[model samples]
Target: MTGAPPDVSIHHLRAITNESTVELPDRVVEILAAVGPDTDVLVSDVSARSFAAATRRSYSKQEPNLVPFINSLQALGDELVLICQVEHGDELVTAVVRATDRSLVAATAIDRSVGIVHITVQELCARLRASNAPGVELALEVASQCLADDRVRIFEQGALSTARTVLTKYTMAAEKGFDVRGLDGFAGALVPLGDEQPGFCIVQADTSVGITAFTPGNADVVAAMGIGGLSLHSETTEETG
Candidate 1:
């Protein structure tokens, strides 16, 4: 990661929804600490499910490869997210890597503009301890990717399917603001706790709402699940409107 770049930025803990957008890599970790360490930082992952079924101009480059492009990062053991779209941005600039936990090198930012990023493990150890070169192979490659993260088992299995439906009712939420993400099959925005309220969730009296997460595997069950609650219905009532 080259190190030394974290000083409260991710635009300060990202939380942007409504048509969605999130790009906060601490200014790409301060431009990868002003570039060095022999370059080699390649990882392009414009995810959140490749915008509802791959089509960021179809990964551009003359358009062709529709799906089937995850070559490295070592077998990808789940926790798969990776971003870099920013040519315009509906949103998706993830993929944060400079190697604190190394294992980077997956291509396709349309063609090979990889800066590698699929952060978590606390934004990859706060961008590798604000990377300026968190050496020792970037702290043993971020401690073997925080012991092989697996996106915290895919965000605790989407937070136990939103904690077993948390008392049902198209129960929308966001008081503590959780986060979620679905890539490839598309899904990102309201990742934390915002949408998913086909019904309840108003609490305006000065508001309180807590809980900081709910995953449902980041939803993408075939698309159609904007976050919070309503994994293609099991009861958010059959009408929702």
Candidate 2:
């Protein structure tokens, strides 16, 4: 006989700012808890598990019923907050919102296994940050500029070795680099160590390799290699420049 389905669980909860990662704050927790046990929370179907699937399943027009809920989360502050809830053998719900004028960037539910919820959320966060976060925009801009310059080719002697040197130069120039843990295509934050700025590089791995850098107020020279698809080997931090 088949075993009973797994119970609902919160797979991930964290707020990301330009500076650091913040655990679910007390106020935000209270708002979510207030939805009450009896509320019929809308969750996505199991078939839409990956990012593409979730996007396909997303509502073309925001549901009026969800507006208040989204607003409540956005009211918290400007920090980008992500919440992921999973019910094994059933549905998964994820919400991402922030207070840059307070809007919901993403709210989706998909069929997902409990084992992979963390990975799913990590990817979701990375994509959202890359496309939306101002800090990430600045970092990518720096990277793109480096790619346009021929001078960046000086470090292409070895793929992996060049990647390390590139990252090292970036870390040194930025003053620090915060390890981004599980996300591919993301190396780390290349902002000043103590400054409250948000800047990060996206490294895509391929035959060649290089690095890039960014500063909050002024631009600085970094590194660059090649470009195509995005992939980052966690251990080596190797990716396309």
Candidate 3:
């Protein structure tokens, strides 16, 4: 199917509920009747329950730079796919995120139309340190896949907090090479390198999974210091965090 969205029938649109109604843009709501009653659909934003208030500032909306998602319950048709799986245009669009308490909780995305799907800090960090757990490897694999698409964009989140990103150059081409399949986009490779102890490192390989050492403006140091990798392309360079 070329990974692009396909034409969905009218019999598949899911309605939005109070729980996951945040991402539903006004435009998406306007198109609901267009999909017909039976159209298939999916939703990838917001949850019946709130995400854990784990950010540096839980008042994310107050700080424009800290927000993760922007919309809720708004899709054009019945068969809307936010991340090729997260359904949109449906009332049951709330996504379940693994909470810190070991129970599944609902978390919403600002915009589920594209980019990487968040697996949650608890799940991601644990998996990244699991010795040989497939979760860490899978995250790397998705990041590797993203660099291939010319339209993709990779942005790293501070492994710990909402700090600005360090590396600006991210070249995953054959010269340096990567080994992953079904990459979501360039955004995947932008690993979150936190400055906390046990910094991130980078290991080269046909399919080797390693850490990425990163410090703001020290992209060059990652080489000698055995740290995380950085993004490439001068044009992509911005003071973006």
Candidate 4:
């Protein structure tokens, strides 16, 4: 895996809910059919409760840009469908259309970009507690293991606060050239540790994690986690709030 080209574009789609049952639109079906076998695709119900049978490939490659796919589902005007395509050496393309009206609600192409670093467990715990999102105790346990180990695997639905904590720690570790891996299904923003550096805040989509730091040596690990890489830089200064 290599760094995403600096010129990569980020796209956005709206998120809406549909409670009716509707057939997959022909245009969407066509797009899915047009996807080459070499391309990786994942189709899931709007609830993301289960991945559709269309998911045909390992998620080991670049993380699929899901913003458009998720957001467009609501516009489908009935049942929602998510289609994420990742092609070799190409930008992630995600699009969804309304089956009833045949209108393209959202489509976007995005490439992985940068992320922050070097926070202590105490501070991490403080932030988690401050978030007031549920599951702080469990998040603390995960954070302790994450800080102490080179890699740790967590298989659980983390609370929003838990996700934010992991994102901060993982980005921080990657910045320090440590090989970090494995956490899924959480959402949060990357807040710069202090005011000296530009304040970079990213409110990521659900089930997506972004890496703010990475070296050539750890690219494979970063890719395996299916998280985007951001190139932001920051100091090791602690957060006083």
Worst 10 residues of 4 by lDDT: 192-201
Full candidate order by TM-score, most accurate first: 4, 3, 2, 1
> How many clashes does each candidate structure show, in the order listed?
43, 8, 48, 9
Candidate 3 residue lDDT tens string, 10-74: 33333222234334444334444443465333212212122222222222433353233322212
Worst 10 residues of 3 by lDDT: 218-227
Could you tell me which 10 consecutive residues in candidate 1 have the lowest summed lDDT? 197-206
Give the TM-score of each candidate. Answer: 0.20, 0.21, 0.23, 0.28
Q: Output candidate 4 Cα RMSD.
A: 16.8
lDDT values, one for every candidate? 0.26, 0.30, 0.28, 0.30
Ranking by lDDT: 4, 2, 3, 1
Candidate no. 1 TM-score: 0.20
Candidate 2, residues 34-70, lDDT tens digits: the string is 4445332221211112222223223213333344444
Regions of candidate 3 where Cα sits further than 4 Å from its true position: 1-25, 31-48, 51-132, 135-241
Error in Å for residue 151 of model 2:
17
* Most TM-score-accurate candidate: 4
Ranking 3 against 4 by lDDT, winner: 4
